[model samples]
Structures are given as C-alpha cells and as structure tokens.
Target: MGLFNKFFKGPEIDQAKSDANRSKMRACFDQAVENGTEYKLAAGYTEDVSRFNYGLVHGSKSKIGSLIVGWNEQNETIVVVPTTPDLDECSNPVYYRRSEIYKAYRNKYPTDAFIIYPDKKGYIAINIFEWLEDESNYIYIDQEAEAKAFTDFFMNHFKTK
Candidate 1:
C-alpha cells in the first residue's frame, strides 16, 4: 500500500517554499506600491510562454522561474517581477501602462493581443504585441480566476465607453 501510494501520489507541497515565494511576491508588490498614491489591486503568478512551442507541444512553457504581476492604481500600470523558484532572487520589474494595454486589447488583429483559449485547457496568454518584442513572448497565466480578475480590473478601471 505504501509503495503504491508513493508511486501514484503527486509530489508533496513544500509549505516553507510556498511561504517563501509568497513573501517574495509580496515584497515585489510592495516595492511597486512604494508611492503612497499607488496601490495594488491584484497579483498572480505567471510563466513565460516558450519561444517555439507556444503550447502546441507538451513543453511549451519555461517553468524554471515564475513572474509576479502587480497592479498599481496611481500610474495605472502592471508591474511584472521575475523571480527564481525559491524566490531568493528577482530581476527588474517590467512595467505595462494602461494606455498601452488598452491599445493592445483593442488591436485590429484580436489574436495578436490578449488571448484566452477556451479549448486550450484554461490557458490564458497575454500578448502585448510590439511591447513584448514578438509573438513568442506571451505571458501565460495558469489560473482562470486570476486571469479573469486581471482582465476585469483593467476593463473596469481603464476601459473607456
């Protein structure tokens, strides 16, 4: 029974590691909101969509590190901070302003911007068009609810009638 469980069960969740990651994400979020006028609305983890696969193959994402998304109200910007698996280190934050995102969302080629594939097993890809360098630089959000929240927040606050 023990052997069967060991083989069938998934890897155990490391509570300490999870907590550390959360703390690191929070710190990144805090830094983005350093200005008293800026505040965070939503945050979530993200993965870098592979340059070649684009989820067409099994290994379509580089899961080596994760990114933390932070929303700042003052500047209407989304800051993405990349971090290592253990959250011990982080790179510079990438800022995406509302005007730029809104423009991308309203792009002529709808598929060239934000895309949520209903048949793609809840895969949500955010493509900032030229801002992202190329089509292969899409940011993948794993959680559907978080993705929806991010879209909703952007629309509710920045979308013009």
Candidate 2:
C-alpha cells in the first residue's frame, strides 16, 4: 500500500522550488530593465505568482504600451512599457498610478477578458476597446482562478469611484 501510494501521489508543492523560480524570474526582469530591452514576461513565468498575462491600457494603437505586472516584497506593482516605434532609447519607463485606474472588471466570452474600464468614455477605454477588438492582443492566462484573483486584486487595490 505504501509503495502504491508513493507511486500514485501527486507532485508535492515545494516552497524552496517556488522561491527559487520567483527569484530567477525577478532577476531576469531586473536585468531586462537595466538593459532597456523590450521584455514582456511569458505567461508560464507568472504561473507561480498568478499574475494576469495581459495588461489593459488606453490610447491609439501607434501610441500604446504594455503594462508589466510584477511583485515587489509581496506587493503588486504595474509598470507600463511603451510599444511605439518612435520612442527613443532614453525614455524612462512609465509606472501606473493606482489612483489613475478608474475601474477594473472581468468579462467572460470565448476567452476570458480581464478588463480595466470596459465602458465609460475615458482615455483608458480606447485601449480596452482596441484590445477587445483584436483577438490576438490579449495574453493567455492558464488558470481561471488565477485570472479571477488577478482581477480581484487589481480592483481591490484601485477601487473605482
């Protein structure tokens, strides 16, 4: 019975392993920032931390950016990395102000859409609209619970008036 149990047991969650992976991912992102490269974290990289792969933004397609969600000492911080081709090498990274986020919500369709200001004609809405129109624009988060949690955290942190 012991042998059968051992053989059939699922993989145990190891704290040490999870910590090591987090450290490695952080280092990689830090290095990318230092080098000023276009580095968007892959979905797999955030699987352990449960960060939503896609980030919603506002503005025209030519003047758009990506929101890079990261953990700092267990606190979630989001940084916007511009994608415009006109951006020079010297432009500093833009970090989202928690106060500026008007609203956050999740939409369920063919693929889950974790949205920020889905309606309400604000500057942020344009980006959400664009992302919604383009099927390929959003990132694929593997776990539904993780996706919901990510949206919840964002909404909780930046409460809408």
Candidate 3:
C-alpha cells in the first residue's frame, strides 16, 4: 500500500488510474515540471536530500508552499504550488485564520458548513485531501482572481513554474 493510501484511503494503484493521468488532475510530478518549479511527487526537497523533494529543486528561494492535488484519473496525483504558506500570512491574523478558498463557498453557500479548524499542532485533523471533497466544504481555487486576498497575497510572492 502507498503511504497516502494508508491514511487517505482512496483507489489503489491500477491501470485505470494510470490512464487517468492524462486528464485535468495531472500528477504533481508533471505540474512542477511544467511550471518550471522544483518538485517531485510525495517527496519534499531538502538540501541534504535532493531526491527527497524534486519539487524544491527549481523552486523559488523566497516562498515555501505546496499543493497536494489528486489526478482522479488513473489515481495519479498532482501537487500544485500554492500561492503561499499559512505562516507567511501570520502578520494578518484574520487572513491567516479563516482565509481559505472554502471561504468563498461559505460566502456563496447558505448552510452550516463544517469548517475543519486546525488543531494545536497547527495541523488539521486530516490530510490535505480532506479539504478537496466536492460535497464537503473544501474549495479549489484555480484562478488567481478567484482566490481570496490571503491566497492572492501568497500568490503574489510566489512564482508559479
């Protein structure tokens, strides 16, 4: 079993998923290469460990960000570079606190949505995919304009490959 499968629990490695890689949800391994940013699937880059994080290879020196997305097809995965990291927006408390793509949905949808609050460790109770479910409150901000101010702030500083 894959590391993510152990926790995330989704489709297993198979041919159908392999064929899915050609679709909108290309794996991170491909997007990082396309964006000209440094990165690899699953591995984050480190000075001592080059192979560990291929994504960080050609990454920006100023920004630290990552987006673990799923290429539902073929069950492959893609990791886009987010506009910015959460901590960087710390100066603006409100932005850092409740500023997420889901906010846009909350502003639009009329319901008591279940907002997943970060815990004491600064990590949410689940993986990033938890925020990507369609029925769930998760929001995917693809367009720069669609992003909230906080997201825009991060995007402004970080360069997409």
The weakest ten consecutive residues by lDDT in model 1 span 128-137
User: Which ranges in model 1 have alpha carbons more than 4 Å from their true place?
Assistant: 1-20, 31-37, 41-65, 100-102, 106-148, 158-161
Q: What is the per-residue lDDT of model 1 for residues 1-161, given as tens digits with 9 covering 90 to 100? A: 99999999865554564445446557655664455125442233344545555566555546333455666655676666665544445677766666654332322252433432323244334432111211132222123455456666656654443
Distance from true position, residue 13, model 1, in Å? 7.1
lDDT of 1: 0.48
RMSD of each: 10.3, 12.5, 19.9
- Per-residue lDDT of 90 in model 2: 17
Give the least accurate 10-residue stretch of model 3, judged by summed lDDT.
86-95
Q: After superposition, how far is residue 32 of candidate 2 from its true place, in Å?
A: 5.3
- Model 2 Cα shift for residue 154 (angstroms): 1.6
lDDT of 2: 0.37
Rate residue 60 of model 1 by lDDT.
Answer: 50
Give the whole-model CA lDDT for all candidates, comma-separated.
0.48, 0.37, 0.26
| Candidate 3 lDDT score at position 117 | 29
Point to the candidate with the largest lDDT: 1
